[model samples]
Target: MRKNPVFQNEVLGAAILQVRSGRARSRTTLAKALGVSPSTVGMYVDRLIAENFLSESGVRQGPMGRPRRLLTTLAGAGWFAGVEFHALRVQAVGVDFSGRQTTAVVRPLPAEVTADSVIKTILLCVAKLTEAMQGPLLAVGLGVPGLVDPQAGIGLHYAFIPDWNQVPVSSLISTRLGVPVILQNNLRAIALAERWFGMGHDLNDYVILGPRSGFGIAMVLHGKLVEGAHHAAGEVGRWPWPLGGGDGTSQELHHVLSAPATWRRLAGVSVREKLPEDLRAALVEFAATDSAEWQAVCADFARVIGCLQLLTDTEVFILHGPLTALGERFCESIIRAARALAPALATAPLKVVPSVLGDDAGALGAASLAMEAWSPA
Candidate 1:
């Protein structure tokens, strides 16, 4: 048996993307763009064509040579599914080979946050969306909360669920669905989603801020997602708030900035406001308010953003997850505060905006990851 040449080869995948994105139409140009020899690129291009992932459509007349054949992607070659699941909900989306989403589904998680229940919900969502798919489901990308070892396809730990540690989640899902499955941290998945289809589409450096039940971030620097040596590049939840010069009373940024924190603080202050037990509803209440507590929350959150700007110096900060419900005004406040604190280091402007994909980003990002991780063959 022979292994597939196109499988897991960055150069082969790059060749397909170069042609699909219209960045390179000829083997010569693709070789130049990828910084590889023309013959090397030609080999991959030919293999891609044979695999139905690429097709030569026409020719380009060169100024000093014979006509070069032009290549284009075959959008119907295959499709992918992405799933994002946490303790509360499950979301799934389907996209074609060209990265166009065809269908999506969202469902509340079963009361029990067991691994079995979560995987079952994911399969159901995929099945529901599969009915609307335009091609074969080639792979799946899963966005999971907490620590994930994507290369190993394992869910390392998720504090919210019991017995989620070291679960072979990707393999279990793939075995049930009969397709290759990949895992990504949910927050990181949101960043990838932004890169492919949302706010960070045009920028190479940015951060995805998750201020929902926790305070974490996903950093994309120099056109690549940064997962530290331990795969915890953006796990800032445990970091003490205020970065520096904080009194001994300072708390973890996660507890200070999370929606549950806000609700807990409010509940302690007064009974006039009815705080909802549901986290989503609580977030909505938090978003609609401008009380002293909310203002304090904004100011503290702004300081973190300010510190992030000074440290990372990324072009944009995209707010994802439940915090996005705070709307454009909340982002504007963060932007103003961050700029005031960081000041201008360069001529480029700083941007803090809400995610374009909103709650759907995690799932769609999972799908984008699947698409990015695998090339049609």
Candidate 2:
């Protein structure tokens, strides 16, 4: 039978993505991971090598078999710009074809942020990266903070900024930059960062619990990101607190578990503009003390994790954002509370790991999006 060009392009793209993301390193592994025959993978690999999109690093000698050739992306192939912006700041990173970040630029948003200002800042940051890297920019991927229609390339709404509804952000940027632009929810983008380059790279199912200025989650089930019907699947922030409670006055998890809420409860501040040394010390002491308020906070976190795990059967819960500053003890407290809530959770293969990407996760995730969208064809 003959081959479809579109299908061949998809397979080729997947092969490149797997190699760039470290999911597969050889044509054999790539074929196994992609569910394609070795010959099919070889065909695409040869084409990619000819196109300068991939290269053979060396050979891996096994104990009792022919050495397997290692596959890797070529850095000079091209580059992509990834930008993640929120009410507070904008982060941009330049990633080569192999998914390695060449440089990152971060700029704080003014006290009053506008859509135009945000776009201008992003363009400026991309220009800086373009100048610094001196490589051809293939495309741009943007991680926007609120509801977004990724397929439509539109930002539906962002509560943080007024008049940030139904903005043609993707086209605006693409038109100005003269390249293709892809958009995704910021939290979901962070989840992509983990799935592509962080700890969740090897896992098929996991959750990224984001509790920074806001509370939300991004889930990966069966090696695919769950975008949901309305692109708001992990908007757990809007879930009512107290689990099954139906009290009309119950606060949303966003208000109860977010860093701002936690800080307000502990330090009488709603925002984390500058966590003073004394405040940081106090936070550490507070967690160590296990005071009533702190325990309540931990208990709330545990309930969220337990509920999500029960719903999704996720293997790991990667914690990201300001709450991570509380240290591993905080994670321990959540685990302990979850076990107390349900003894089964204690025996379950559940892991709560903190994110290693720090503030660059969203930016890196956006870059992954761009890399995934690019095709060698």
Candidate 3:
């Protein structure tokens, strides 16, 4: 197979980014790490600077010669928009070149939000956010809770938002805003955020499980997000099993483990509004008890994790979304149950940790997608 020459540039760019992120190293240090000539490293750095992707800063004085200029990413060169739509709300965040979030807005959406209404709301939010940015917007990224085709910027299917099926979200948004756009599955986006800025950074392989109004999983292998042949690598919630057998596989996982589901399980309880502290406390207490309902939910999650682990060979599993955010104890319980059911194929210690990015993972990941798209090597 003929290897693309640009692949080498991409590798070098990624290496430079890693160094900038990790230690803010010099060109000589980068050359050492990349096993290349200092002059070659200088050429790459110069190109990056000319492209406005990188900048040099304060010099570090060494004992031998002149002060060395530190190379770093040009964070304010452009802005990226990140949007995440959930069943009940839509979140939009703007991130700068240095991966720092500059603005964030959250708004509630009606149960039956129309496509036009959603698009209008997104535009309004973007307009407001861009007004606050330091530079022109370079790209936009949208994360939807469904199967997304990044190449086409379309959503193939979304159980929660039926109207989103086959929606050319990227083209619609980009055309309206006059900027480049990228679309991604919400779970996959979150997984990417975890890999870049959260717990998965140190691990080469891991799984991110989000148990919210829907259940989804994302697998990262060899430090790259693994989207299968059809971009459906992490649809673990749809896996056929006793809980998700037959037509159930077509249903959203949110219907099984969401707050509404828990409220429904408790007779005469309403989950339409934000759960009260007392109600939250009660649910956590019940989960701690050895009740049939709690046991069933925990067992189902454990089963899902076990199945995913066996299939993906991932060493760490991150539990995310509202369910895990309910409390530390609740998350620990789920972790314990999953650990008990895990297979021995995992040679390294398995970590079932909570997501540090919380609900922002999707938005952050979307921003990252925009960065990758706008600044491709």
User: What is the C-alpha local distance difference test score of each model?
Assistant: 0.80, 0.85, 0.72
Model 3 lDDT tens row, 1-377:
11565766675556545554554478887777767788877877777788787878899898998888887777787788988887667788998877778988877787677776677777887887887888878789888787888788888887776676788888889889998888888887887687667887678898887766656777889878887899887776664556545764455455665555654453234545455544434555454455666666776666666666677778788877655534555556656777776645334354577677867778888887776656444
TM-score of candidate 2 versus the correct structure, residues matched by position? 0.91
Check candidate 3 and list the clashing pairs: 213-254, 214-254
Local accuracy of candidate 1 as per-residue lDDT tens digits, 1-377: 12455543777777766675567888888999988887767777888888888888777898888998887777788888989988888989888887788888999986767988888889999999888886788899999988888889999888889979899998899899999999999989988888778867668899989877777899999989888887778888878865784689877888767666656664455434554656555566566666777667777777877777878989888887666766788887766665555556233366788877867889889988897788544
lDDT of 2 by residue, 173-235 (tens): 999999889999998889888876788778889899999777889999998989999988899
Q: In model 1, what are the clashing residue pairs, if there are any?
A: none
- Per-candidate Cα RMSD to the true structure, in Å, reads 3.9, 2.7, 4.3
Residue-pair clashes per candidate? 0, 0, 2
The stretch of ten residues in a row with the least summed lDDT in candidate 1 is: 1-10
Which regions of candidate 1 fall more than 4 Å away from where they truly are? 1-9, 25-28, 58-70, 242-250, 260-291, 339-349
The residue pairs in collision within model 2 are none
Residue 167 C-alpha lDDT in model 1: 90
Of candidate 3, the 10-residue stretch with the lowest lDDT total is 263-272
Winning model by TM-score: 2
Q: What TM-score does candidate 1 reach?
A: 0.84
lDDT of 3 at 247: 69
Model 1 C-alpha lDDT versus the unseen true structure: 0.80
